[model samples]
Target: MTNLKLHIDYPHDIPIDAFQWTPETTLEPFHTHTSLEIGCCISGSGVFYFEQKCYTVRPGDIFIVNQTELHIAQSDEVDPSTFIFINFDPSILLLEDEKLLLPYSYQSEKFQNHIPAETSLACQLQPRIMTIHEELSQQDVGYLSRARSILIDISVLLLRNYIGSISSEQWRRMNHSYRELRQMLEFVHRHFGSNIQLADVAQTVGWSQARTSRLFREYTGKSLRDYLAQLRLSEVKKRLVTTDDLIANICFDCGFQSMASFYRAFHANTGTSPKEYREMNGLSEDFEKLGDANEKSK
Candidate 1:
């Protein structure tokens, strides 16, 4: 019998979401508020598409995606693909005094530029990912705290592994690129819901618009514009699930220019219209509240 795995936990306040998917299903293209992602394959095999490169993954395999990289997952064979995804805000690793103790320090250098398929780091990370998955599966309080600790441990392991591999000069070069990328990412996160232009983003990162476009595409496998659009749509979905804002208001709030554009993009990305998507997802109450709020404000 083929065993496929798909599990999701919608925890409140953390802005992180976890889910599992198997060969029988495919997940839509999605981005997250969390800048770092760690996933492990427990059984079967699959492929992960990131910034146009396809990484073949299997049991006992793991991959780390830097923040805001456009990615999708798919199963490779009839065997069910079982894996666990751990997502978290990058700020969790940026505590003032502890900032230097992170993998992010190795930025554009060999460590950041190359993604080793099966490293000693992978061996260290597997247990941490597994432990977190177990804790999340539990129906206990403080699960969020437990998850956070595991994530921090994983980050430390990555930093240590990276430091062992390169010279200070290499580290310095990579760190420079890493810093620029981090800044670029911060700008996107902060202003995704505004009238952001590609040239503006380039200027913010101190790179020419063409160079910035190439680097972003190289790192994330999607154009800057498309990535921002995905981020906006993701924010809109989160609001739809958690707030009572009108669809039109949510659309504008998410930086969409008009209801028509929002509808087209939403449907193209999510396979459903905003109104119908909300209704189908048992958000009828939210739909009604949005209508009521609009009428009241008039």
Candidate 2:
């Protein structure tokens, strides 16, 4: 089975997405998703549910749900809550500030999910979230970069606000874990489009499979299987736009042996059929044919 998390339909090449959410919004309930999510409550009231606790969300409240946590939300029937949510892969932070990974790597039980209304941190984050929403909606030139920049700013605020909670030893451990994870990711990328098992990854990092699996989730916010599937999905997309190979061929070349499984995984992650995704991001069929004809004339 394809180990895909809920909210698999993140954009190609863009690692972040911001959108409006209401009580009526559809989502897989209590799934441990692969993206770090930060949400700002805009209006009404709601409760965010975790296995052990519930947080009542109100306007100006900022909630952080780390990628590994199983969580869900619902609003009061009388006045449904509305929110602006920004969900992103943690890998995006590596380019800007790898240390920003600190906030999301928090211990779930000790961490405070809800930043209450009156906190200046909440006030600080709301505008940045709004700016991200605008950049995403408008999609102006450099919007992708701009939105990521804003997200980094938000991360900084969160780090500053939560600094007291993280101990010096934990900070040291995070840096060390990041180094180990970097090695593991590089190994996986080198062997992408091949069958990679937990044992394979464990050997690369010189750790037991159990240790590798646990730390991989802590460091990357994804299981080994899901991470590999995502890598294959990314490669499939690159081939889709850059090459005109048959979809089945491209998929099989990427180690997706089953067409049905590959198609389902592609559509689930990209929110488009493979052909549609190609058409949207690459040259049209007529253009391709015209280029081919030009080539023939030569």
TM per candidate = 0.55, 0.67
Candidate 2, residues 5-27, lDDT tens digits: the string is 66545663566898998975343
The sequence of per-residue lDDT tens digits that candidate 1 reaches over residues 69-160 is 55566786576678777765453454312433345433322334224436776777787787777777773667767777777777767776
Candidate 1: residue pairs that collide: 51-220, 51-221, 108-174, 109-174
- Regions more than 4 Å wrong, model 1: 1-124, 131-153, 280-298
Superposed Cα deviation of residue 110, candidate 2 (Å): 3.6
Assess candidate 1 and give its TM-score to the true structure.
Answer: 0.55
At residue 90, what lDDT does model 1 achieve?
A: 51
lDDT of model 1 at position 100: 32
Candidate 2 lDDT score relative to the true structure? 0.82
lDDT value, residue 94 of candidate 1: 40
